[model samples]
Target: MVQKAAAILMIIILTLTAGMAGRQENEKEQPFLVQITEDDPSIAYVLVRMPNPVGLLPLPTEGEYTRTIRQIMPDGSEAVNVLHLTPEGFWMEAANCKGQDCVGEGMVTLENREERVLWNMVVCLPHQLVAELITREEALAMIGQ
Candidate 1:
């Protein structure tokens, strides 16, 4: 009985150690992808699907208009966002967040997708809202290389 228990424990220990090592290596190798930015013909949009009932509809990237996005939280709280889409980039017109961090993120008008993939993100944490921007090449790669 003692030997059997020792063998089981040894297996468990080795399994846990291997899992942790793999996780560390995976984290190091992972490349960060940008999550959100204004509409651009060359860029692809990634909208995260959460428990939230509503989502943003796709709009033309080459137009000039103010888009309003209303998100009602699961807890019955309300969050509102007014966004302006221009030919150059996108920016927040107004929001109802406590910190206004999402509105303060400013316009994400990056021209270089290769270099800015990791930095372009618009996160409204309080409202559980996030937007991600992926390049056209990345989008194609996601489908199939």
Candidate 2:
């Protein structure tokens, strides 16, 4: 009788562990957010959320694309940055800033954001622009979405 109870307990524990693992996997699949801000108080901020890839599609879709963000400075100069997004991660493909430091910041992915030097943000100080990777909850709170 005791042996049967132990077997049942083992089975329950295994099932719970498997369920937790599946939940973690689903969380991993959720999309991340990107917030872009211009230092100038006159210009409005921009927040872009990366879209999750469409499932089971034979061909590629909006899940991967290049987004060009242009911010006009008070002096009428334009700061341009090209952001590249993939299912795996996102990176600054190109920037028109003189320093070009943002381009060198490399990729920010779910797997590596924590370990990165800047955490989840890339900054273009010369242009007074910042691009940051943020969680969905934070994004919602910021925009009241």
Candidate 3:
């Protein structure tokens, strides 16, 4: 009887812990931050904007193409290559900051998560800027309005 009671207590504790963990994870995943759809790939453009403070930002990868857009400093003193992204890896070219995060993030895809999540490639840049992805519905919404 004691053993059975102990097992039940353990199970209850584990269940409660798992529920808390899941809630935390869900909180981390903000729905407004991402907008994914099951539409054409040619019309998709993932937009990411890094927050202030950090000048350099990592880029997002989608499909086989990657684009790097150089950005000017807030003060307009220098044109720095702030966004560096690839299909499998990303790098910040001009920023001298040292961190293993950009290199650690390997190739990420959008279609893989389309069925599960709304946004596939939305990510914050190194400087805390917000990144946005333009989905078909979003684009249509913008054009229609």
lDDT of 3 by residue, 1-145 (tens): 8577556545533533454454433332111112343443434334444332111122233533233332334554322223344443333333322453433333333444344233344333443433343444554464353
* Per-residue lDDT of candidate 1, residues 1-145 (tens digit): 8577556545533533444464433332111222223343444433322222122323236666665444445676656666655555566668898989878876655454235433655667776666544445654454353
Enumerate residue pairs that collide in model 2: none
Report how far residue 102 has shifted in candidate 3, in Å. Answer: 3.8
Per-residue lDDT value at 91 in model 2 = 73
List, residue by residue over 1-145, the lDDT tens digit for candidate 2.
8577556545533543454454433332222222323331211112332111111101012356565554445576756677666655667799898979989999876578799998776667776656665544454456455
Give lDDT per model, in order: 0.50, 0.52, 0.36
Query: Each model's TM-score, in the order given?
Result: 0.51, 0.54, 0.35
How accurate locally is residue 21 in candidate 2, as Cα lDDT from 0 to 100?
Answer: 59
Who is ahead in lDDT, 2 or 3?
2
Note the residue pairs that clash in candidate 3: 35-118, 36-118, 47-132, 48-131, 49-129, 49-130, 49-131, 50-129, 51-128, 51-129
Error of 3 at 117 (Å): 10
What's the TM for model 1? 0.51
Could you tell me the TM-score of candidate 2?
0.54
RMSD of 1: 16.7
In model 1, which runs have C-alpha deviations exceeding 4 angstroms? 1-61, 112-118, 140-145
Looking at candidate 2, what is the lDDT of residue 92?
A: 79
Cα deviation at 9, candidate 2, in Å, is 58
Q: How much does candidate 3 score in TM-score?
A: 0.35
